[model samples]
Target: MASSPLGHPTRGTTGTNRLRRNDRWIAASAAFRTAADPLVIDLGFGASGVTAFELATRLTKVRADAEVIGFELDPARVATAQAQLDDVRAGRTNFSPDLRVSFAHGGFEVPLPAGRRPAAIRAMNVLRQYDEADVPDAWASMAARLSPGGMLFEGTCDEIGRIASWVDVSSAGEPERFTLSLRLAELERPGIIAERLPKALIHRNVPGERIHDLLTALDREWERAAPLSTFGATQRFLAAVTALKRLGWPVIGGRSRWRLGELTVPWDSVAPR
Candidate 1:
């Protein structure tokens, strides 16, 4: 396998089900469902391999032959993940004996076996450490390794998975949409997602930016829908998103996803100015 160019070191902080929201989205994506190869890269899967293992388990439900490779730049972290893989292999974990998962030392370059390109690369919290200017190059590098019609889910989430957001990028490194997922019960305000925006938009949350306007409008509608709170947070969020759509904000997804506390919009609607 080819070696990746060195990139930033992550805090390596991860937890059980920390990326569960992301995994759910991936599992439901067309990239995962239609892939003939069904190979996925868990790029920079923190200090543990549980996320990779979980990814494999979830994807296999969609495609029985799904495969997952956890890539990390830190050799020590790769070794630690291997040890966890051993546990899965030894029947000491919840993973099936037939699980197809591995760990390797790599970075944003996404080193993979020759003649292989992944259908999806989930790089959760990987770029949070880099300067915002470095994101394009990092995105280009990873996007270069995707198969045709492949996708990149890149973003960040909190420690407990209560709040999460991601950008859906195509194989050409073009961002398609942005999505914010939250645990409605824990949500205080829709604007709070500004703190976890993808690197490309995180610093663009200031006034005058498109993202700023979007979030500002979201908060306004959310407050305006406060009467729906008597029904539940989910109803309030659904109402808020509907209000956004009515205001011509280019919101994507339907009440089905909104009821689950998710809101998606075209990338152009919030692209950094």
Candidate 2:
């Protein structure tokens, strides 16, 4: 595997199930269901491989042959995660056999053992350290390693995974959708997702931009849906998404997804104006 010239290490703060929302999204994704080679990459999976292992466990439900590989720029981080995998495989840990996870040291090129392209590449909280201007190159680098019909999910989230927003990019390198997943009960406003927007939309959240307008509209709908709060936070969130859709916004997904505090909008809806 080749190393990156622009390697920026992270603080490496990670916990068990820290990326559960993302895992859920991927497990329900069409990419996983239609993938011929069921190989997924957990790019920059911090100092531990638990998140990748957890994703593998969930993915297996969608595709029994699914496997996850954790990629890191830091070779030491890969080594540490590998040791943990060894312990789990030796019956010293509670991890299941279905969680067939491995670790590799590589950059955006995503060097796999058999020169395989991945069905999905998830790069979360990995590019926050770089300037927003560096996003395109990074996206291009990872997208190039995807299988023909593959997808790339890149985003940022709070430490505990309560709020998250990500962009799904196709193997052609065009971003397809922008999705926000939150914890609705205590959500101050739907605009909270602005803080977790992916690189493509993060800097573009300023006034006059489509992303800014989308957030503003979301906050307004959330307020309008306050009546549903009596039913429950989930109900209130569903109402907000319903409102947005009725208002002619290109909201994707149905009530089933909205019930989980998730709302997906077409990329064109919030793309930079």
Candidate 3:
């Protein structure tokens, strides 16, 4: 594959099932279910290929023809992923023998075979290391590589994957929604995601910003929902998110997703102001 025109070195830090939440969200998205092409790109999959494998495994349930390509700027990481692929091929893991996954060296400038473009791109934690000003250009580059109606999922998560947030961008590079997923049982407050916000909103979490106001309001609602804690953290979170919607926070989704500690909002509701 040709080298990406612009990219960054790999931090190479990742763990098994680190992206499970993100994977679930992608599986539920229209982009994955309706893609004319079932090809997906796992951009910047770190030191190991387990996440890529997990992504492929999860997505295939929705579209049996699903395929995943793990891209890393580090050749060594690519080699490691290749070795993992070999293990899967040899029946060393529980992954389906027909699992369609591959590894390649690439970056924001997704490099695919001639005339090929992906149906979706999951770029988790890839942009955290770059300057905020670079996010637009990086997003533009990747979005440009998507097939019609394709999507880009980009965001960050805590080390063990308990707390996560992502932005869903359309093929036009315009963000459509922002989603925050937390482990309700372990959550202390909704504001905890402030630390893990995607690059675009991390610094903007300070007062006066839309994201800041949103999180602050969410924390307040979470506090007010403490009475529901007798039921469970899940119930408490559901109540909090329900209150958020009632208060006109533009919350999306319903109890089904809130039960999983996920909250989605229109991009304009939390866009950096």
On the 0 to 100 scale, the lDDT of residue 6 in model 1 is 57
Better of 1 and 2 by lDDT: 1
Q: How many clashes in each candidate?
A: 0, 0, 0
Q: In candidate 2, what are the lDDT values of residues 170-264, reduced to their tens digit?
A: 99888899999998888878898888888778888889999999889889988998888889888888888888899999999899999888989
How does each model score on TM-score? 0.97, 0.96, 0.97
Clashes of 3: 0
TM-score of candidate 2 against the unseen true structure: 0.96
Per-candidate RMSD vs. true structure? 1.3, 1.5, 1.2
- Looking at candidate 3, the ten consecutive residues that score lowest on lDDT are 1-10
Candidate 3, residue 156: CA error in Å?
A: 0.2
Best by TM-score: 3
What is the per-residue lDDT of model 1 for residues 1-273, given as tens digits with 9 covering 90 to 100?
334445888897989999988998999899989998899999999999999999999989888999999999889999999998888899998789679999998888787767799999999999998899998888888888999999999999988888899999999999999999988995789898888888889999998999899989999999999999999899999999999999998888788889888899989998888
Best by lDDT: 3
In model 2, the worst 10-residue window by lDDT is: 1-10
